[model samples]
Target chain A: MRKTVLVVEDEFLIAMDLKLLLERHGWWVLGPAASVEEALALMDEELPAVAILDVTLRDGTVSLVAEALRAEDIPFVVASAYDKPEHVGGEILAGAPNVGKPTDQRLLLAALEQAIYRMNGTSLPLDP
Target chain B: MNLEDLYRLMRNGHVQAQGIIDTVPEPLLVLDQNLCVQTASRSFFSTFKVDRDETIGQHLYELGDRQWDIPELRLLLEDVIPKSKAVVDYEVEHDFPGLGRRTMLVSAHRLFHPDNISRSLLLSIVDATKRREHEAEKDVLLGELRHRMRNLLALVQAMARQTTAAGRSGEEYRDAFLGRFNALVQAHDVAFSHNGAADLQQVVERTVAPYSGSPAGVIVEPGPTVPLASGQIMSLSLILHELATNAIKYGALSVATGQVRLRWEIEEASAPRLRLVWQESGGPPVAAPASSGFGTQLIEFAAKRELGGRVELNYAPAGLMVEIVAPLASVS
Candidate 1:
């Protein structure tokens, strides 16, 4: 089965743009859910192979969602305007992969792929 | 008078003076000409956390490891007090023992007694520590607010660049970008009016009020008031503005007799949620557009991403109806 990815971002244009970009990459997208609650709702119905989350939302931070994803053994990357990990959560999110907002599409994809492989205990294939 | 009688009188006078100092509410002190502490009020001992043995008969600077050794304070006591015969409202900020940094207003006056030749000074202190800290905190909050505003402007700048890059004509790009910017402004206005938390009804009313045409033109059935955070308010305002702009240009609001009804309700579930409806009627026949435009995409994306809700836009023959269902916490 093709890998599925969940996207949780609050910015409307950014979310739409990311959705289109991810879809073009041959991954089934679960959601571009805006808030933590909505992201959790999507997770309850089905767990995506990987996820992308914004650090801040309308209601609160997405640390809870990140914690939940961690608990489920699902890999996820932070895509947010906040550059420093301390702004999100210092030690708790220290090792997780992240892509800053106004992000380069290529960088985001690379991070997502890295997270997936890291979770699966594998390494990316060397370029021919 | 005999020397014994003079000694008895001086002792009695000192006892009476100590009694008066103990009754003062403000932190007060009685000091001799040499700036040695003769007495301190009960308030002074508790406020500065100094004990009786640590203060009385000691040089002021020697008390509490020289916490009172402030250079400015020394000037006021040794220089200003003597030349002026009194120092009023002398301000000093210092790190006192046990207490952190404190701002204090010190006032002193030379005491006079007809029967005595020596000079004693009465000093009073007003602690402004809490007030200063509160002001400092307000400054920090204001700075953070400014930083957020600058970031918002930067986001707008990026959006403008992207919109132009998407191959829009000059007029089309200007109109679309300005519409979005104004929507953001409306959101900020509402958020600021309510101190960063705006009521949902108020936000809706503010967005559509301009297009209402007349008093009954847009019927806003009051709904349960929901407090939305600054970010939520901005996103909702953008969505509503987009919908209203569409209504006026192509939907129900185009005609004079057109009407738009707005209302919302709380969905009591495992977690409470908000359900809003925007229904329009008495206008041109409606049909779904051939393709989704930027406006439509914004509404759908915001409802899904910003509010954690579902958006359903039905273009019926009669008019257009939009339903939004999202978690209350997300929207508010």
Candidate 2:
């Protein structure tokens, strides 16, 4: 089964790039949601196996989405450009594994795998 | 002492006390037990825009249309100061008649004269408005800087990741990345130079400068000044950069005699919209690309998503023309 990953980013180019990058890595990409409302709306339909979130969005911080994901016990990683992710996302994002922007693909993928492993006790295989 | 001598001594003491308060600099007021103004410093009279005659012998609360009758001031004088003997840096915010809204640090000390039986309160007012304003401004600037820094890094990261390396040498990839990076930097510099908004003409001129080495290669028609918000400026700058880069590679700027004309005007409607046109002429015969590349996608994304606008790309055999229209509300 293909594991789905939710991508939340506001910038158009960044969102497009992340979507393309994650898809190329063989994970089923759920969204490049531009705002918290959009992200939550996407989740209402289906929860992804894991998620990657940008701290700031056009509408507001991604705290609401983070809270929703936490409530569901879905594993997630932060891909942010913020110097301090916790300062912006507050307690909800205080300890989330952050793959800071200009992210190395290796590190981002590794962190995502770690989050999945921590949650499910086994990593999902990347699709060939 | 004789009666006349005693009165003379008291009057001299009052004059000396007034002179001492006058030299203390910050606005000072001496209030009796009833909170009536006993005497005020020269600074107080000048600072509050009141004469000594109108200020002295009047209730402190009744001064200047009763602007001084602040609840915080009453609490400080009637409740806090009596128990504490001295109250320092008690903040009171009030709108004064001529001075507008101001923040003041009101410090008061209960005064006791050894020979005199009467008690007074020494109140000093420090205008803290400018200091508070500066602090607020600093906070705004820092937040803006942080926000811009994060966005800028994300943009650069996106550019790096999306700049395709397929069918290109390592050197070619470096050139492409650097070109886009330089454009981003230039756009940021221009956008932030004018207090968070950039003029449209300047953005166009700066973006096309590298490709418009020849005098007539890129013609930017002088248009009415259109100011763009920071986000719009960044999007427009990158769009222009991508167009210019494509032009230099295969369009107008590729040939010595080719030219590009950039023009913009405000369209009058219920909501004013800014219309910008980029036309390439006298270039190699134009043909629509077989596939949409990074440049095309970037231009589309920037116009539609970033600027909240629509873009049309026309590949005329004579030249390539692109028209972009965005709401004025988003521009400025």
- Tens digits of per-residue lDDT for model 1 on B92-152? 9998767888899999999876677878889999897787789999977885666466446
Candidate 2 chain B: minimum summed lDDT over ten consecutive residues — where?
B143-152
| Docking quality class, candidate 2 | acceptable
DockQ result, candidate 2: 0.43
Which sections of candidate 2 miss by over 4 Å? Answer: B1-151
Whole-model lDDT per candidate: 0.81, 0.89
Q: What is the lDDT of residue B86 in candidate 2?
A: 88
Question: Which lDDT value does model 1 have at B118?
Answer: 79
Q: List the residue pairs that clash in candidate 2.
A: none
Question: In order of the candidates, what TM-score does chain B achieve?
Answer: 0.59, 0.59
Give the TM-score of chain B in candidate 1: 0.59
Each candidate: fraction of true contacts kept? 0.18, 0.62
